[model samples]
Target: MKIYKILNNNAVVVKEHDEEKIVMGSGIAFQKKKNDIINRQKVEKIFVMNEGNEKFQELLKTLPEEHIQIAEDIITYAEGYLQVPLSNHIHISLTDHLSFAIERHQQGFQINNKLLTEIKALYKKEFEIGKWAVQYVAEKLKVQLPVDEAGHIALHIHTAKLGSGDIASTLQQTTIISEMIEIIHQELGMDLDEESISYQRLLTHLRFALTRIESNEPFQVMDPDMLEIIQTKYAKAYTIAVKVADYLEKEYDIQLPSSEMGYISLHIQRLIT
Candidate 1:
């Protein structure tokens, strides 16, 4: 790949096979000029132009080298753990978030995540990785970040896992799932085992349900016979599902069709048993 432009001593815009890529590493672009062939050995990370050149360039201009490196490390670890490729936008969003977080910590300003509990409850694995990230960032950046910041980082990973660029919607989904879980717990008069397979299944169900709700997809129609059987057999679970449906209707203005109720009640029955 040949250098198309140099962003800094450690970063450069390169072109390979007629496609633009932003490469970064320690001294990767030092003394390099446009049209110079890049030394692949110095490259630490390569960001494809999956989002857009303009947005990538803007990030390259303002994001510090350390911040970018930290984001890259986090993304690498998350991808391995998730067993899925994350969206390229995480490169930008995570870096920006880390940069701002570091700045806030330095300025003695701490922002609390109002959805911290919800995020932790809904995204357990990601939240654990986020906590690890907190320690990693602290050791590397020599600054202490609050536990709430871990929740924020978890949300970023959650957003990447969903492949959705809208952080707001991702957060809303988290909130919705957490609220539903709380409702189930309250109605059942018990604390849920977060590590239980049934709980995990419930979370997966809510995750996709929120996706459908957000995308305005119509729910599948259920057979009256099956719906009646489910409602009669798992009356308690079906009642809890109704509460969840009512919450969704009031909060997001999305109705849960009978099929949704059946699925939710089935998951609830599994959890209750």
Candidate 2:
């Protein structure tokens, strides 16, 4: 890799195998240089930058548009119903909330009413950004995201609502597990065997799953095909977790992706195993 243009000391424009790409860093890689060849191994962290290039721009442009619109909708909905902002109520930070909202739209789910009504009512500025975020995802990913999937996805993407202020590779899996635990805990009401090492291990795995999502790291649990393991070993937990997810979707007016939910349910099963 060669330094095409030193964007900053920590960052530079380097082509990957003769391909044009955008890169970012904390500082400029070169003081005054263009077309300075560099090694891929030498570069620290490189990312694909979206510069609104015509061809690629066409894809992501709509995403921001949709994001802003969605935010507006959320704001309006909240003001009309809950009279508060979802962020204020949940203490959900803004960055993660927007990220997850875009992702959920990418995966094809709709935002729901419960928090939607509140978000719109309180955080008008954040809601504006949220709407823009929806559009950004739409255009950037070239995925015409639906509005319904915006709210929960936004919540999941927002580290504020989930736990941290960032997303992990295991985010989808983490959301499922977190929601499952909340549901089951509500029902069982501290009945889980706290003294049992098995219970502790299960909680550990669940936490790990969430960390993965926040770090954008691959999920370690389902690295192998463990769905069967869940089904065979902890059938009750798996069944209960999934059922609770479905019930929440209906009762609370939130969207829960089944595939993501199942991943968490599988981890919950590990608790009993």
Per-residue lDDT tens digits of candidate 1, residues 100-170? 99888999997798778667767788898899889999899888899999999998888887556478888
Candidate 2: C-alpha lDDT: 0.48
**Per-residue error at 234 for model 1, in Å?**
5.3
Candidate 2 least-lDDT 10 residues: 87-96
Question: Evaluated with TM-score, which candidate comes out highest?
Answer: 1
Candidate 2 lDDT, tens digit per residue, 1-273? 666654334445566776666443333344547876554454433445344323322322333434333443443443344343343322122323554655765577664644443233222344454555556656655765555344444443343333434434334444455455567666544566644655555555555544554467764334335566665666676677667757656754544444445665755554544
lDDT of 2 at 238: 67
Per-prediction count of colliding residue pairs?
0, 70
Displacement of the residue 121 alpha carbon in candidate 1, Å? 5.0
RMSD (Å) per prediction = 3.4, 15.9
